[model samples]
Target: MRAIQITEFGGPEVLRLTELPEPAPQPGRLLIDVDSAGVNYADTHTVENSYLAASSLPMVPGAEVVGRTADGRRVVALTDNGGYAEKALAAEHLAHDVPDGVADGQALALVIQGVTAWHLLRTCARLAEGESVVVHAAAGGTGSLAVQLAKEFGAGRVIATASTEEKRALALELGADVAVDASPEDLTDRLVEANGGRKVDAVLEMTGGPVFDASLAALAPFGRLVAYGMASRVPPTPIEPARLMGRSRSVIGFWLAHCLGRPGMYHEPLDELLAMTADGRLRPLIGAVHPLSEAARAHEDLRARRTTGKLVLDVRA
Candidate 1:
């Protein structure tokens, strides 16, 4: 089987296409023949060795895949690892049959990004109706879905931020009430202004460097900010406890990988997300699709923020 492997952690160039033996099936695991694999910030983090979880070298860096099981069951899988290969292993319970009419790439999105977006709003943030929400990186994978889910969850005002006008436009099209520029330096002011000169009730913050501070500052009294990823590769500045206490605001953190530790927290929300996608109420935008051999280029585009929507590797090609 062909796979993209990173022998050492580094840049996109480190992702090398190589020939490898097919994975043998294991008990309690589904052996999947890859159709497509989702490219995510987590994959880049795994390669850079900067994620919340530690990974050893000589790794195949992909987390979500849409593929077929041994019996030809089409499924979208949450891979423990080795997702970059033509064949991979997945825990049976985490593997789900892809809903009819959902494309392989779109099915791949539901496994990680879709589930994360759902849990972030409906669970972690505890967003309420008529409340204002700010979503940073609103044009990217999770953010795009988060923007839509916020609306579906009855948020009165949805403010989306993106680095480019084109991406920002996409955010609005997905249901954000307003779209702002995502320049980290200007984030706080832009978010406040978008909410009619007041702080927002909730914020979905993933870029953990400078933007984390700005987003936290933009939250209203009793507001909640869900911190997920450090996409910028910079550790976020610590928040003062006194500051949050003063306004009764809260900062909550979520990592899908962590929730996997408590499997009980995942199933319900994941089911809701899959249903929504199946009905077309939630669409996982396909920004870029690359052949497996072009995995390096895909990583480059995502890291550079030069792509919008979900990035997927068309492994069947």
Candidate 2:
């Protein structure tokens, strides 16, 4: 089997596509012949040795993938590691069937991002009908899905922040009521104005650093801010404890990987999300697809923020 191996931690260049022995499933696990692998911003951090789970040298570095079980059923899995490979092992419980209506790449794109967005809106932030929500990186994998999910969850208004005009337009197309340039200066003000001078009730914040502070400021009283990723590569800064006290606002952190560790936690939401995708209410936009051998270039595209929606590795090709 061919796999992208991270022999060392540094940049996208560290990812190497090389021949490797096929992986087999252990007890309670299933072997997946990978058709596609999802590339996330976290994959970039993992390659740089900056993610929550440090990688062992010469290991594959992908989290979610679409593949087939030994029985030949099409499925997607959130694996512990080794997703950037032609073959990988997945815990049976973490695997879910890919709906017949969803294509392999689309299914793989939705599994991780869709689940994360679903949990964020439905669980952590508790988005309510008629409430306003803000989504940072609204053009990226999770953000794109989050925008649509927020609308489906009955949010009255959705404000999205993106780095480029192209990305901003993409957000609006996905149901964001308004899109703001993610420049450090005007994000909060623009978001507030877009919401008719009302602070948002919930914010799905992925970028950290400067944007974190702005997101905090843009919250309404009792607003919930859910921090999932720090794609900006900035260190977590001190948030004023008094801010939460004064405004009755709350900040919560979420990691889908951690949430999935609890038994039965992910199943219900995943089923609902998949049903939405199958029914055409929710769509996973696959922005880029790369051959397995071009994994390094794929990583570069993600790290450079040149790709939007989801990037997937086509292992079968």
TM-score attained by model 2:
0.97
Candidate lDDT (C-alpha), each: 0.88, 0.87
Q: Write the per-residue lDDT of candidate 2 for residues 1-317, one digit (tens) a residue.
A: 88989788899888888998988558998899888999888988888889887677878888888888879999989888899998999888889998788888777767788889988998899988899999999999899999999999899999998889999999999999999988768678887898998888999998888888888898999999999998888855697888799999999999887777786668777888888888999888989999988988988888788888989898988
List model 1 lDDT by residue over 155-203, tens digit each.
9999999998998899989999999988888789999999999999999
Could you tell me how far off, in angstroms, the CA of residue 197 lies in candidate 2 after the best superposition?
Answer: 1.4
- TM-scores, all candidates, are 0.97, 0.97
- Give stretches of model 2 more than 4 Å off: none
Q: Give the lowest summed-lDDT range of ten residues in model 2.
A: 258-267
